[model samples]
Target: MDRRQLEYFLAIVQTGGFTSAGRRLRVAQPSLSQAIRALERDLGTPLFDRLGRGVGLTAAGEALVRPAKQVLRDFATARASVESVLGLTGGRLDIVALTTLAVDPLAALIGRFRAAHERVDVRVTDPELDNAVTGMVLEGDCELGLAESPGGVEGLDHLRLRDQEFFAVLPPGSAIDPAHPIEVAELAGWALVSTPEGTAMRTLVDRELGRCGAAPRVAVETTHRAAIVPLVLAGAGATVLPPRLAEDAAGRGAVVVPTTPRLVHGAVMMWRSGQLSPAARAFVELARLDETALPPAGTAGPTRSP
Candidate 1:
């Protein structure tokens, strides 16, 4: 059968009905039904048994389902591969994030990658809008997506390659007993400057705060990680920050305190196997920081948050 017929058939199987399948495929319902019928007739067997409003895949149809999906996926992959060769390192590069990742190693990785793949053009999109990114990737609008781990995209492979833990950024010269790491309730004593209350990272922070028997005293809330450092530097209050974002702040009078419940943040790479741009694939491979949090580049400085 032609790719069009194959695509319609697969859509039908995936959506579990002719109408829904046609909607997803963006083809008229009758047209999709006709294509499926043509495919079944050409194969000389009933592909699906229509029982009332529901339909079940027949033995032969079940057999075709797996290979059908592969055919469609492979076809899309081939198209992307061809397009990639024509441009960025022979393909296009696009990215998405969740605010947190936009701040740190993503820039580092992109800079290093562009230096190596000078011919490859890369475009970085705002990290706030992930739904659009996922939709585009699924529809082959972009070559790759970087996002939070635990994304629920079907039919795509996601590789989680980087991780960082939450560290409390203490205000410059604020005194905390060095013997015992501060508890959450004690943390509440400090004016709290943090990300917005309902954000993903904030939610995790709240949960951990509850676990440690303390409620955060809300002082200043912002989505900006860079702002967190200055707020703390001005003695606004303590806030949770990733180690990389708090980098070298100790010298600037900021203390990175490690928290006990370990609020580690992670980044995942999402891409389907196909023809991929060398730049995109390299970013995926090289961008994921060592998931294993290593010893810091220097000796014990201001202690990281518990």
Candidate 2:
């Protein structure tokens, strides 16, 4: 019936119950129930069927879901369009990204974006697991996201930034050949220090190893990307790293070897398929500019892994 009512309705639908929806919306449960009742009265039909533990959308409620979502998206887009005309004065941009990506292209893009629009404030949330980044975006906690492609969410759009190449991070002076790409089978022989289970790198490693019918002998597991290097340096085991990081580690005397089959994965910038706030749009534009002007991957000098 109204924007607030639509918001309450959608929240209930998404969260699957009135109590959780009320908690999420930060409103009293009674008030949330009243609002939904009001919405149902306006629609001339009950939107939800009460369940033993939760609620389910009735036929009418199901019908309202898609349009309600679109309406909310359109309203946000309209507000953003108005804000864009104001030239991004004191706008804020929220972003969620993977740790490894936050250290590279995302960091650079944020720097450039800030320089271009001094009034816009940017906040970045780096999650170790890739899905958390997508979750942040999907839940409307962030306006922008940078991570591996094929986010698998409907109504979101993304652009490929680059194919991030993964390299083997070996101990200092390891016998593994640096000049040639190491086969997955060969790398599996060494006990590996790996990023923890949920990270993109770990997923990549497991998928590749599984495809090869081999498994890594994981010696140590860590959540922090930086920790991988020190463990490897201490000869804990070899680990995989992205190109710039590998290059920097190599510069620091770590044996950086390319992987066999060239373990390259795509990184993308993703946003919902509606209007972005002026600041967010500006940041996206800066990212686009950076992508065009930047040389092919690995062309820029190595950035030392911190």
Candidate 3:
């Protein structure tokens, strides 16, 4: 099947309907349908099954997703190789980031990368699952991934960007004194605003709390990482957060304090092991420079809560 057919197929999968995919691709609905039909004929199988007004991927379509994405990424990389002669005048860089690490290092690195390569379009998306960043990067869904990789992934090249320290964030007017570090066990009595179980953050929280022989009294469990701070601020419950986020929460009137046995994780950038596109290489280099500017892991002193 042609690249157009693959593009149309993926677009339909992403947008959830042929009409929506047509609008996204600026193609007529009939043409998009014809392209998919042609692709299915070439493969001798239907890729998508009609479901009322929507469509769902059939087994064949599910099987094609990874290879289709890889093919498209390879095509883009080929084009980028030729375009490199012009020095990153324009290209797309797709990144999948863990929800927790997305705002701090990713945002800062992207800001610097964009400042230097204004024409490059950087698209950042969250992984479907907390630990799915590596799989997404390996599957060619993204060129780069930012994740909590205490031990780097086996098949990918990685650069440890920073060590993140987790802190206890309490709601406004918390009786706990900010000057004193708190033990994880002390948090067991209070309800927590946490991400769902199985998420990286929740797993860490559970492990630490379990160490104290206490389980979290979860008052609010949300999949939306962004809402944790707000929920805590609203006095729903306390939460565990990284230093950067905890500091922000403090600035916004939440009480932040270091934990007795500090919770820390290494954040790393991962990519395919071989040669990278010029834009991706430049981004990696920028990350390296940024990392160097920061205080070495564990050396950076604790942030005093506001």
Candidate 4:
């Protein structure tokens, strides 16, 4: 019904109960309940169903979630627009990136962007699935998203930032030479520690392995990005990952062998196909500058950084 009511509803949904939402929003429980009840009345429906442990959204509440979020986004955009006219007073940039990339290009870019526009806020969202990054952008949940080889998403404008090389993460006491590139066939029949299926890196590795005439015998599949390091280190099995992650783990005495054909993954910065907020545009420009200044892929960047 109103911005405050919508805010309250969203908070309750996120925190899972009126009391929790009140604690998060620093509002009294009774006041938060009253606001949501008023919103439900205005819409002529029950937004939440009371349950013993926690409240769950009713069908009507589920329907209102997207539009309510959009309303809040628009309000933030409107405020930022007026403030920008008065010279970058208050603005925010919301970005979504893959968990692996949170270490590289995204970190450097964020650091540099913040230095220039200290007043503008920047938030990064890392979703579990690779597709969710672009989905967030397309759904108007975020202003920018970093996706790897986003294949033909209908309504996105993207720029290729870099192509990153992949490395073979050898288990402890691996016989493979760490100083040289490991040939494709070397991966055959090895029990591999891997990320879950459908992740960008996992998909790429699977395709490349197939091309090299082998299939991975997955020993363990995990969703956490950092879990691979410990798996390989503990001698679970060999794995393939972006160079940054592989090299970082190598410092722990894990052998990281390069692939013969140079397994490389492409990264793109994508956004919705429309005009962007001033803060978003500024972030893009900063990325462009950083990309130009960066050394050719595999030569420098997070993977190569000491």
Candidate 5:
């Protein structure tokens, strides 16, 4: 009912128990307990039920969790708004990016943006590559999300920023030639560092290789772009990734091979339904820039970086 009571309940959920929550919030244990009890009394339902170890959320608790977080965020925003009436402050940018985007373009974009806007703070929320940005949209946490074309998110504003294509990254001394590119059949003999089966990348790679009546011999299965690049550079195997990722990996001495049926990647910038922040606008500008921050890509869509 009250902010204090809501805060108490949230503390309990986040820290996983009355005692731990009290410790985290720097509140006396007894006061934390009383506040939660008061909140339950106001709502006329138990928020949490005791399990063997700490505690677990009841259905009611689960339902209230997100709203509680939103309320807390709102309160913090309100306080910050009052302060900003006199002076401005830059808080964190809750962001999520797709796997392919996380490499050079995204990293370069972040570096450029942060360098310009030293007052702004940014936070990332990359989970599994596929749903990372969409999840941020659904949760209403991210201010802006950079993603591949996520098929099913609704009630959000989306803009296509740029496109990328996948390339074969070959190990040092690899027989695969950078100039010739690799054929669908050529992939079968090499160890592939692959995304999990059924992912967009995996499906594309598998389907392409299969069409040639071949399947890559997978050396390792991992979800991180950083991992794949290194394995290729180390001469362990080859992997497929977007152009930007390929370029970075190849800089460390791996060879990049163009593949049959060029793989395409898209970058989408999505925001929850609302007005834009000055910072968000600046980021949108940067995201639209060509892999290089110049020429036709900049002249075409979006505006200059702020």
Candidate 6:
């Protein structure tokens, strides 16, 4: 019913209870409850079902979630527009990136953005799934999202940033020669330190290995990106990684080599197709400039919804 009520409602949803939401928003529990009650009354329906020590969204609440978030996002954008006159001296940019791409490109991209707008706070989160990036941006949970291009959602605009090349990383003292590229078939029967199934990297690895009449013998399946290289180094198994990460693994005594014919995917930056907050706009411009020096890949430039 109001911005404050919507904020309180979303906070409760995010933190999973009124008590935790109160802690997060620094509002007293009674006041937070009163705000939600007022909102539910105005909407003519109860938003949440009372559960012992916690809460669950009612059908009405579930329906309001997306629009509520969009309203808050628009309000913030409106404020940001007025604040733009003060320059990029202060603001916050929220971004969600695919777990696999977070380190290689997102880290460097954030580094450059911070160098220019040092006062702006940048927050980055990883999506639960590869396709969830588009949903997060569309629902206004994030101003920007980085994921594999040819996004699954339709209401967002995309900028093709760069192409990431995958390589095979083997443990120390492996018989493979670093100078020679290996074929996908050769990796068959070997244990692999892999991310869980359905991840972008895992999908690519599976498809490629499947082509060679083999399936991954997953030695360790984990969501922890940082542990992959270490596991490979520990001789858990070989894993596929992007070039930047593979290079780092090589420096740490892991044998890194390119797969024959090469495995590559296009990394993209995506946003809702509407007015953007100043910080988000500046981040997009920064990406555009960064892309200019690199060779073009899929889509060639920014693409928008019809």
Question: Candidate 1, residues 94-162: lDDT per residue as tens digits?
Answer: 666555566655676678777766776677676443445555565554556665557556856777655
**TM per prediction:** 0.60, 0.72, 0.90, 0.87, 0.81, 0.93
RMSD of each: 8.7, 4.7, 2.3, 2.9, 5.5, 5.7
Q: lDDT for each of the candidates?
A: 0.67, 0.80, 0.87, 0.81, 0.71, 0.85
Please list the residue runs of candidate 6 whose C-alpha ends up more than 4 Å from where it truly belongs after superposition. Answer: 295-306
Predicted model with the maximum lDDT: 3
Off by over 4 Å in 3: 50-52, 150-154, 301-306
Candidate 6: tens digits of C-alpha lDDT, residues 153-244? 58888888778878888898888877777887777777999888868888888888888788888879998878998999899999888766
Q: What is the lDDT, from 0 to 100, of the residue 284 in candidate 2?
A: 82
Greater lDDT among 1 and 3 belongs to 3
Candidate 5 per-residue C-alpha lDDT over 198-293 given as tens digits, one digit per residue, 9 for 90 to 100: 455676678778888987788888776567777777777777777666666667777777766565555677886665555665677777664344
- 243-295 per-residue lDDT for model 3 (tens digits): 67887898898998888888777788999888788899999999998898887
**Ranking of predictions according to TM-score:** 6, 3, 4, 5, 2, 1
- Rank candidates, lDDT, best first: 3, 6, 4, 2, 5, 1
Using TM-score as the measure, the top candidate is: 6
Which is the better candidate, 2 or 5, if ranked by TM-score?
A: 5
- lDDT of each residue in 1-306, candidate 4, tens digit only: 788998888888888998899999999988988888888888899999999869999999899988888778777777877778877666778999987677777888999888888888888998888878877887777889988856567988887887877788887677765667778677867888888888877887788889988887888899877788898889888887776677688778788777788888889998877667788888888888888888877774223112
Q: Which ten residues in a row have the lowest lDDT in candidate 5?
A: 297-306
lDDT of 1: 0.67
